[model samples]
Target: MHYAPTWAADGDTRRRPPLVGDEREILTSYLEWHRATFELKCSGLPADRLSEQSVPPSGMSLHGLIRHLAGVERWWFHIQFAGEKVPMLHYSDEDPDQDFDDLSGDPAQALALWREQCEHSRGIVAAAPSLDATGIHAASGDPVSLRRVLVHLIAEYAQHNGHADLLRERIDGATGS
Candidate 1:
């Protein structure tokens, strides 16, 4: 059977607005749009397809992408903003590439895990009082504002969503604008 692109809220449906607001709202709007884009990218994919590493050399799949982004979001929003070294999905000091390297498993399990991580990451972003709130940069020992992190996350998601678009096309001949 044919599958609708993940970005579609309903099967073949696309009613969601792309973005909303002014200059002050740009960061949040961009982040939300990217988040929606991520959801769209993952929308109609099967569990198996979602986890399949079609990009062999890169070993990047939609599920893996979600996992990696979740870890990234947690690092920035939770650890940095909240000042806590919370454990993250697919993260490890010994194997910095663990996220990409260790993705062999049931597709359903991986997808579920990714969904959970996304929800948690969203919560972190939502809990923050403002984008101006300060967060410590783990690498630089410098202060970074939540606003900066939000922008960075938006960029990251936008880039990955592009990859997702291509990957999905390769998988099933479905395409999105």
Candidate 2:
């Protein structure tokens, strides 16, 4: 049975990124659009379906992607950008792929965490004086600008959205951007 995601935007609800806007507006809009797209792709499936590894030999699932994106948000925004001391999500150096590999939790909970991280990320961006605001890259010990992080995140979501699209299609033959 198909279940429409109550929280996520369908085609009608998802906002179109402004064709003309300030740099910050443009970037944030695109990021928000991509996030909604990811969520949209995950809509209309039961938890079992969401967590099912429909793509054979590939461990990716809509639920796993949600968990992975939550971890990405924490790693980039909370840890790197905001310099928050929050514990990493579904990760340890000993088990780097836990987010995608483990699918034992409620998909709702994972999506909730993903939403929380996204909100925090927006706050960090808002608090910054400009896109030039810098964060320390944990791995490189190098300065990374908010602009770079935003662009990188957009790319990350875009790449993952493609995966989401395929996974969604395979699970139920549903497809769209």
Candidate 3:
């Protein structure tokens, strides 16, 4: 089945990463690409479809993925890096999987939340002194650099985007980048 273009229309010069760039730029570029890919996977679908846990036996849905990513971005950047005293997003000791399990919220709102988190992440990255800047890992209480967080976030998006692909395909026969 046909799907909308995964990216912008032809000739639309997006803020794409160059073939060559500095370390920080390259990492951020790759991270941004994965972020866009995840969004692309979620586009052009209704709320009900986005909330559908297509792959049964695993309560994973596109809406859930969006929530999860938003939480992740906040955790890594605002909470972990910036050490903000903000409340956790979609998470708790009792309901750790709430982001992935709770599908009652509006999908549009979930997506908007994710976008906002992404914007915050971009701001955090842009304002940082350098990729080598250190942040404490909440769990381990050990120092973790901004570079490490960027790579981790990129990997997270890549893995979940794969899930989004399968979920989308199962919802409708649509597939591919």
Best by the lDDT measure = 2
For model 2, the superposed segments whose C-alpha errors exceed 4 Å read 1-11
Choose the strongest candidate by TM-score.
Answer: 2
1 against 3, candidate with superior lDDT: 3
Per-candidate local distance difference test:
0.71, 0.87, 0.86
lDDT (10s digit) by residue, model 3, range 7-126 = 465433325565677888888987887888788788888888999999999899999999999999999999998888888889878998899888889999999999999999899999
Off by over 4 Å in 3: 1-16
lDDT of 1 at 134: 86
Please estimate how well model 3 matches the true structure, expressed as its whole-model Cα lDDT. Answer: 0.86
Q: What is the model-wide C-alpha lDDT for candidate 2?
A: 0.87
The local lDDT score (0 to 100) that residue 122 gets in candidate 3 is: 95
Model 2 Cα lDDT, one tens digit per residue, 53-123: 88988988899999999989899987888788888888788988787898999998888889999998988
**lDDT by residue (tens digit), candidate 1, 1-177:** 122233533453433333454433666656666776777778777777887777657677877777777787778777776677777667778877776667676656765666676577667667777767787888788999877887788889889888888877778876774
Model 1 clash tally, residue pairs? 4
Candidate 3 Cα deviation (angstroms), residue 146: 0.3
How far off is residue 137 in model 1, in Å? 1.6
